[model samples]
Structures are given as C-alpha cells and as structure tokens.
Target: MDRTVEHYERIAATYNEHWTYNPDYVRGFSHAITDALRLTASDAIADIGCGTGLYTRRLYEDVRPTRPILCVDPVRAMLDQIPASPGLQPLLAEAEDLASGRVALPDGGPLDAILLKESIHHMPDRRATFDGLAGLLSGHGRVLIVMLPKSIQHPLFAEAHERFEQLQPDPTEIADMVAAAGLRSSVSYRTFHAAVERERYVHMLESRYMSVLGEFSEDELRAGIDQFRHSYRDTPLLRFDDHFAFVKGWVPAR
Candidate 1:
C-alpha cells in the first residue's frame, strides 16, 4: 500500500488528464454512481481514495452540489490536486487508517455514505478495513464500494488487464467481507462505455494511465502499443467496456 501511494503521488499532476478526452463518459459514470447510491443533497459523503478528485468533483456537480464531502487518500500529492472548495475537504489518510480510527474525520456528525471507488484493492486488509469503515457510518449510513471486477476485459492493454485480474477482488468476496463487518450488503453491476480516438487511447497506454501499467517493462509497453495499432488500424475510435460493481453495505439505524 505504501508503494502504491508513492506511485500515485508521482503521477498525481497528470492523473486527471487520463480521463479528459471523454467528458461525457465521466459524467455518465458519475450519474450512474449517484443513482445507484441514491444520494441526496443532504447526505454527508466521504470519497475514500479519491485521486485528483475526478469522481469526487463529479459527485458534487451532478448529485449533491451543496453537500460537504470528505475526500481522503494516502497520497498527499493526489490530495493536493483536488481543487480548493468549501464543500470538498481533503484528508490525508489511508482506508485502513480511517477504519481503525488512526485518522479521524473532520468534526462532522456522522457520514451517510462512504465511497470506495477503485480503491479497495489497494488496502492492506480488506475485511479489517471494511469493519473499520462500518464503524464510522451513521445509523442509516451505507458504505459503497465501486470497483471494476476481474471478469471484465480491458480493451487496450493486455498487461494492464492481467495485473488488474491479479489484484481485483471478486464481488462475492467483497460482499462477504461487508457482512462479516456486521452490515447487510448487496451487489449490483453496471457498464460504462468510454469512446476514445485510437490515437488518444494509445497515448494513454504509452503514458501508463493506470498504475497496473507501471509493472510492464518499456519494451513490453512499446510492444503493446504496436499490437494495439495493428489491431485497431482501421478503427478510428475505441470503445472500452467499462464494467463495474457497486457493493453496498447498510449500517442499521440505531
């Protein structure tokens, strides 16, 4: 987890640029997330592992504009990239730390929702972390874990897909973890399509848009790009099959 934080810190400056090529795609995903969670303007939410505040900002704009959100991440550089706003509070903390109370939320009464977006895989202990987060919720609070399951195919880079499969947890496993944390949980699936120009997609691959790409060697990356160019030479746009799972755990009202 420490090394993962370092990697994100190094790439924090340009991280949001990875998704800039498709604004509608991002907006759609955010809308789906907001709908799935049934978030309201009065709900107090926390976006854990919110890198560069991409989705965090979207949540504010598309869902709960007036609500204050706590954006937490282990990387200070990533947190720094989040724009300064009265509604968005940046906290320097890891998932496990937040769960264990090593890091505390800023004097808010209680959180109505805690969102773990593409971040659960990075935590050291999944069950313990979930248990900790469960402790922080308000009586009716829910913990939402948004993730890309291992079953989905990565369209651009094979190496990144392989690494994702190696790290991603199964949806059932996450649900069980939530249940073990003493919360009743359910899982739902959604598909988001991101259409990017072939050239831009290749550029994102070459720039190592995902942390998984960092594991590939320079030669391997070049080879992957060559393979992509050959495979999509005739296709001007690449449509990514972005399949995701929303695992929700409810904290019963006291």
Candidate 2:
C-alpha cells in the first residue's frame, strides 16, 4: 500500500481524535463544494477519497441529493465509519478501480458531481485518473478537486515544512492536468482562519495529522514538536489560514 494510504489505514479508527476542524471551517468548505460543483437535487454524487465520510455526510445534508451518493475510499476501516443509510453507498476502492472498469457505481450512470477532497495527491497516475473521470462525467457534471498549493502557510517544524513542500503538488499543475483530459477547468481559492489553543495544535502534530509528519521517525517527531514548543511558547493561540485551492473541471456545453 502507498505510505499515505497506509498512514490513513493505521490511523483509521482514531482519525477523528488526531485533529478537530473548526465547525465554521467545515461549513465553509462544504459550501465551496456545493458552489463549485453547482450541485442540484438530482445530481448523483461520488466522493472518491471520502475518508470516514466526515465531509461526505455534511455534504450529503447540504446537497440533499435524491440520487444515491457513492462514498468511495481505499481503506475499508475508514469506509466503515460511514454507516449504511438511505441514499448512501460505500465502495471500498481506489480511483484506479473506477478508471480501470474493475468497479462500477451502484447506480451505473455518469456522476453529476465528483469530489476529491484532500486526497488528489495520493493518486500515482494523475493524468490517467483524470482522463477516466472526465469520461465519466454527465454533460453538465463537474469534478471538484480540493488540494493545497505546493506551498502552504501553516507553521511547521523546519524539516517537516520542507518535506511537505516537497511532497505536495502544485494545484495549478493539477488544473492543467484536468484541462489536458479535455475538460474545461478553473481554479479558485478558499481560506479558513483557524484560531486554536497552541497545545491542542501541538497534539495534532504528535498524532502525525499531516501525512508528511508520518515520514518522521517517532524520536524525530518528538524532537520536532519540542522545537516548535520552544519557538512558539509565547503563542498561546496558534492562528493561521487553512488554505485550499479549489480546482473544478467540467465537460463544456456542446
């Protein structure tokens, strides 16, 4: 398994314990998905990397789609967090599963809205994966990929910061990939101002909340957090913008 996926797999059960999203931040992101996808009551939705269905459930409520929503993820444990319910179907698979025809949506039709929230960077074959998605879109459908810019603003331990920049792709390049797949693509930005207790934020680091943090050894992570504490001791409340690059792709009107 890919290390990123492995990271999630190991942390699946306690996923919610690692971090807490500001309720306002979640609301903003949910709104961004609805607005960018221009979702409708009848749109069949698919959340490709719907970990624990945290946002998926919220999104389901906001869109209130009449068609069944497919919540797909590679980790079975993470998928299990989403309870079986009316209008929701959980699929244990990766993006490649859909692209390679190994799996099919329960409804067996093109999707009207596709979401890849915080998970686009995990795909090994971006071009091929997106080409498949473009082909799967209904005429009026849209795929909204939520990713961070290659560079980010969140304060991190020095080495962790450098490692994150190394790993994260430039969101602009992803937009280009979407265009190359023959879809009309546009990029937008969203920012969530987070104010959290400094120690609470540090615990998120120790939990390896960010995948890049997983690359660090236990001792290294301990040391890194120690350094962060020493440097940020005076910062009782850590304030930063949780930034997002919203990349939206759609089949243009014929």
Candidate 3:
C-alpha cells in the first residue's frame, strides 16, 4: 500500500478527533453547502463522505425538521465519533458505495440534496462515484460538490495537488464526470476567508502541511514546504477565497 494512503487511513482517527470539534471550519463549510444548494425545508439530504461528521451537526441545524439527513462515509472510526441526533444517521460507505443499497433510511426514501464537501477528490474513479450518487438520488435530488481547484498556486494547494495529480483527477475532470453522470449541473465560484493573525496563519500552514511533507525525503519538497511557510508566516491571513468552487447537479427522476 502507498504509505500516504496508509498514513491517511491511520490518521483517520486523528482527523476525526480534531475536525469534528472545530466549529469555524464546520460552520463555514455547511453554510457554503447550504448557500450553493439553496436548501429548503422539503429537502432530504445526504452528506456524502461526511468524515468525522464535521458538517453533519451543522446540517442538522441548517436543514429543516421535515427533511431527513443522512451522513455517509467509509471510515467507521470517523463516523463512530459523531454523536447521534434525531434526524441524523451515519452510513459506513464510500462515495462509490452510495448506490450499493447497503444503507437504508428509516423512511425508505432517497436524498434530495447530497453534499460532497472536500471529499470528491479522494474517489478512485470520479465518474463511477457520480454514477453511484445519481443512483441514490430522489427525483429532485441535487448533488453539491465543493472543489478546491488545482491552479490556485498557493503552497498548500499546490503541494496537495502535486500528490493528487499522481492519482489522475482534477476538478475540471470531476465537472465533466458530473455532466456524464446524466445530471444537469452548474458551478458557482466563492471564497472562504481564514481570520488569523499573520503569524498564526504561518503556523497553521506549517504545522498542518509538514504532516504531509513527512512522506517525502526529497530536499526540494522539504525546502519548498519550508520556503512557502516562511513566505506566508508574516505575510497576511490567507483568504482561501480563491480556490473554492461548487458544482450542483440533479439526477433525472426515474
């Protein structure tokens, strides 16, 4: 197994631990999804790839009581950490497993809104993943995909995409896959701001990024990560408003 993948799998527990408790990231992400989808009281939503249920609690708050929301992820450790709620249910499944019919809702229904926040890039096959998502959609279901574009050129974005490209997928490729999934899709561009002191932004970038750099012994990678960290440490708080985009689509009713 690739050490990076194994590392992520092992750190899944840690990711859950930190992310689930972070309110700022969760609220911002949920608001992004809700805004993009124009979520209504009648919507039955499923947050696909809901790691650690970071945004699931927000989903519970933002979505209406009349609508049932399902949280799905393949990582049990991540899902298990989430406390249960009245309308919230967690399914242990991958993005490609959405249509596997492994998870059944109490009401025997399909999803009206599906949120793929920051998780779409992890799928081995974007096209297959969309197909699975389409299969699980209710007639009026909309799938909202939050993607961080590759050309952003920020150090963290660039480093992440360099490794991601080796996996052979890009946001544009995902948009194309969404079209091919036989859904009507459109994209909205938006920005997310990080409110941090200049030094805090640097620390945030370095501390989080170094974890990934540990995988490589290449002096260039090491140097690049460090240089990026130094250049941004006192520069300014990162706006992150550039790399964010969302694609919303609907599966035709059967």
The global C-alpha lDDT for each of the candidates, from Candidate 1 onward, is 0.83, 0.85, 0.66
Q: Rank the candidates by TM-score, best first.
A: 2, 1, 3
- The digit string of per-residue lDDT tens for model 2 on 67-89 reads 76899999988998887878678
Give the top-scoring candidate (TM-score): 2
Q: What are the RMSD figures for all models against the true structure?
A: 1.8, 1.4, 3.9
Query: Cα deviation in Å at residue 66, candidate 2?
Result: 0.5
Clashing pairs in 3: 191-241
The estimated TM-scores of all candidates read 0.93, 0.95, 0.77
Q: Judged by lDDT against the true structure, how good is candidate 1? A: 0.83
Tens-place lDDT per residue, model 3, 149-214, is 655534463555476445434666677788888898777777755444555544444444323444
Candidate 2: give the clashing pairs. none
Model 3 ranges off by over 4 Å: 1-5, 13-25, 102-107, 153-161, 164-168, 197-225, 236-242, 252-254
Error of 1 at 247 (Å): 0.8
- 2 versus 3: better lDDT goes to: 2
